[model samples]
Target: MAISSTLRSMGLIGRCFVHPIFDYLVIGGGLSLIVIPAVYLLADPPVMRDFTMLPWFILCSNSAHFAASTVRLYTKPGSRDALPFLTMVFPTVTLGVLTLCMFEADVIGRYVQLIYLSWSPYHYAAQAYGLAVMYCVRSGCELTQNQKRFLWWIAILPFFKVLLVATSKHVVAWHIPEQLVWSQVDWRGGVNLVTEVLGVLAMALPLVLFAQVWLTNRRSMPLISLLVIMTNGVWFVVFPLIDGFVWTTIFHGIQYLAIVMIFHVRDRVARPENKRGVVFHTICFYGMCLVLGYALFNCLPYGYQMLGFGAAESVLLVIAAINIHHFIVDGYIWKLGRGDANRRVVETVAIGTGA
Candidate 1:
């Protein structure tokens, strides 16, 4: 009887803004990254390299997630009035930059691709931090400024580690003549050691902070929040580079799609003018994202290929351009300021869920 009572209390502590299953499995990446890995480890399932080749998986993730934020921005009522510059000018500017990259594929395109790759880890870290704090606030787990600062470092430390290792080689290459890129190699070992230390700290600090928060606040952050932080750490630091990119893009897409859909539907339904049901809005929003994604990732690149760009370069440049645009747009659209509609929607959702 005591064990049963204790287990029930433990379960109640982990309550999420969404239902437990959906929030943990989808938004937190637990099912894909954590559960699947444990299953593979215990059962020793046959390793398949072509899992990403599935057609439905291809259509629903990656590019679809990138398209989601754009869909969210334009679909929200008053978006143009609220964010005139982003809604009006950014798309045209993005297209112009993409055209320049297409014309100078070797020079400008390379730099753009490099920027996307470099920025990706930091982007992931920021997403992790944002979602973690959102869950904390929504769950009524008040965090002091000191606690929030600790959480921020816990979220961002992985990015610092990734950045250090990534730039160490390139920093030397950038400063020296082209031919000396190969010869400059001595500094990497020390940087690698430093990153290794950072990696350990990044992996350890989250658990430490989680315990500290619980002790200090008399309430824990939602378990889903911790799952988010851990999953991001695994993506950047624990997984092999090739595997990390493949998995993170797909799973991160899943995470982004789930949260954005929730916010979009909630916002739409709450408006007095909205005549659409949640089901209708969800289907419509995701359907538009799918079509736009197909056009952006497939049709645009194929068009560039037909116009004489190298097929691989065409694909990569388009991806980089799209990603940079998404990163910039996401910066503005999700702000939680007093005037922002997102804050209202988020607070409403939290209250509705009894979070």
Candidate 2:
């Protein structure tokens, strides 16, 4: 009886809220809420700060994304199977392992600040991997020697970025003990330059690929892909300019807005017709607004900190809400305006016949 009831409850939840949008939002928001607070709570007031929770949160987030990619691989019918598996699934596993190593007490002692420094390159590698898989899957024409050489060079870019980051640590080695010194304008200039260059490359690569796809296919790619690109781009640009973990806090606090927008766009486009059953759209929308809003407003920037919690949270909340609404509405137009699946099938067939 208990099992039956639990199943029924889950059924209802799925019916009411289990769309891609809701899935990502809830997963992202939940992980952020737990991870952000946990990081702050665990950090020692005086000395070595415990960042175990951040890694754990990243693990959870990446795991959720991997699960989503798996679902897409199996359920999407015509989607490229190998690309998503190799790119998304494998990276998630790598990230999970990295996170585990960072958080494990034994491993943490050896690594110290190494994990934090490694995160930027690790993500760049993962993104490069994904882009490479995408390039292979979408390589319609036979590749010439020049194209192959270009591809190889592109593949090596992430490693170069990693090397730059590794070397930048030496820039302020003498001032390592002093937070003020490290944070000083002159000392951090080199670090900023290295980080920004990596950030730009990471952000630009996807946009170039997306532009290529748009020119060739003219069909709308998945919103998740777009979101990933946009988020990374924004992170690369905004975070470096702002220059600190505070940006991370702010980025995370309001990232739910982007998740919500993506969901709203996805639902509008996908427009799953099985309306009789329960639908779980907008879980990320409503849930994130509540949870993230609370965190931003109540918990973040707390006390006599540099940025006041209430002020920062309020501003971010407004921005997030507006962006979410705009994305949902825009997505509706983009997807619904293109018509349903049957229409698209007819259009494709018509194009083929015309050709």
Candidate 3:
């Protein structure tokens, strides 16, 4: 509900490190201004890249980050209030049934997979939009009702366009079956034309929005707000689908983790029952995610295979189900508006100082 700096008596060096926007990006988003352009231009070096997926650390870590953040929502008290049964039952049923279908019914499996891919960018953009507005309000960039409405429209359009692009081009051969295609009228000419134009607009909108925000708020508008919104451009507009899966997703997870953990730590500290220290709580939080991630990623496949499910289909189904659950949970948990209790989770303050 209120924005305050996180800086304390650690002086100028401390100020640089302690600021909310800086900490948010560095710790949560896993990026800074310096890292973005370098990443855009850089490729994986010739040497072995990092961990499981090779050529990148992101591949191994992203799923855990996402699962961990979703688990954070469950642990947060707000989720229990906002229609607890739908939050608990819907995703569990979806995952269970879909996993069965993946093994038994190929047509349904493909459909579910397509839906997940189609919905992913919007889910991603939503997080960026929420964070952007939070930063905007924190910095006191007040806008008229219409202006705020337009801001959301701007945040949404790029991902929406990217969805169209996906539909036009269709999924790659390896990711899905030929039956899963979106029947493009003309693969090269008309479809490419539409996709290219959409791609250009998706890339351009964030920059346009950046200019508009600056014109509207001048120096008072936090640069971090603009940067958070533009992160969507990097994710949806710039990279190819597979590479974007690794690069953009990890950053998104980092951004989500940083903010959610802040909420968790704050809430934990506030509760009388929470006797554990921050370090212990942090480990417990992330450790749960890692365990869940392994189960979702590895255990699902093996368990399904043992149960006579198709290995590839089972993996895809489990991944989609968890992601769909995440999207649903996040929609409830981070519904930022006036008088929302979730607002309590993200309130900013001077680090080491009370509100």
Candidate 4:
């Protein structure tokens, strides 16, 4: 009888947790599960051969996102105006380009494809969600100033990741294998310099904006935001300058874990009544931390080659894990926001006042 009751309660929880607009959690989680194993399997090959498999994983993951967005569009047309359309459209277009470039014959083409695939899709998706959250703030969603600040920080984290990877590559040139250093010069002519400068600008822009927001709205910041800022400060600012790739990657992984935990806390606060939502967020939060922890512990110190894996293969696995967690959390919050909007509309109509 106790077991039966437990099963029934679980069933009820699952039903209540069903999202009509987008099965983002399932899609993201499923693709991540598949992509991780596929990457591991494909990693045991020649460098070129291993690199060849990355687009397939990226294509699959991006395709899942595109499908989820399409379903979201169809189910809730009203919510379309809330997010930036370019966020979705650009990823679709870029993913298409990446798909084509994966098959290209030239080495340079593959490198370009890898860079875009690394940063663009998630960058845009985070931006879209950030835009949605900002809309919530504008519409009086009750988010603390700190929450807004944290979301803004996350929205621009990709730029930091790019800069950190590039700078680390340069600063650790002596430790890196001779063959792995593709570009010799720090700043080159034309496109290379442009890309480098843009990277620096992108990384710097978020810090400037974060400082401005904090200064303008210091009183509104939440404890979680403060913690996130401190954690990110240590990883992005303090540690990277002191350590090289091994320690930096480990610390960066910890920072990423903190971000996930902080967001989970925010999501819970945003919808305390939704127990199932809380459970889902908790599952994703811990699950991501577990997976990433395992990867960093087993994969980083050894290096991709030491694990008998190519760089592209290792990147694909790590990215799949991180992106999947991000997608699930973002989708969960978007659905929560939609539900909140509907409740507000009902309340306003019944009360006969917008307030």
Give the TM-scores of the predictions, in the order they appear. Answer: 0.87, 0.32, 0.77, 0.33
Task: Give candidate 1 regions above 4 Å deviation.
Answer: 1-15, 35-52, 168-187, 349-355
TM-score of 2: 0.32
Ranking by TM-score: 1, 3, 4, 2
For residues 199-232, what per-residue lDDT tens digits would candidate 3 score against the true structure? 6765576567655654554423455555666666
Pairs of residues clashing in candidate 2: 15-278, 15-279, 16-279, 16-280, 17-279, 17-280, 18-280
Candidate 1, 14: how far from true, in Å?
5.2
Please give the ranking of all candidate structures by lDDT, highest first, separated by commas: 1, 3, 4, 2
Worst 10 residues of 1 by lDDT: 4-13
Q: Which 10 consecutive positions of candidate 4 have the poorest summed lDDT?
A: 20-29
- Note the Cα lDDT for every prediction shown: 0.78, 0.38, 0.62, 0.39
> For model 1, how does the per-residue alpha-carbon lDDT over 2-93 read when each residue is reduced to its tens digit?
75444334433454646788898898888677655774687643343445465567669878899998998998767899899999999999
lDDT of 2 at 289: 41
- Alpha-carbon shift of residue 151 in model 3 (angstroms): 1.9
Model 3 pairs whose backbones collide:
6-351, 28-254, 28-255
146-241 per-residue lDDT for model 2 (tens digits): 444443444445445444444433234323534565455465577668767866765566566545544444332333343433343443344332
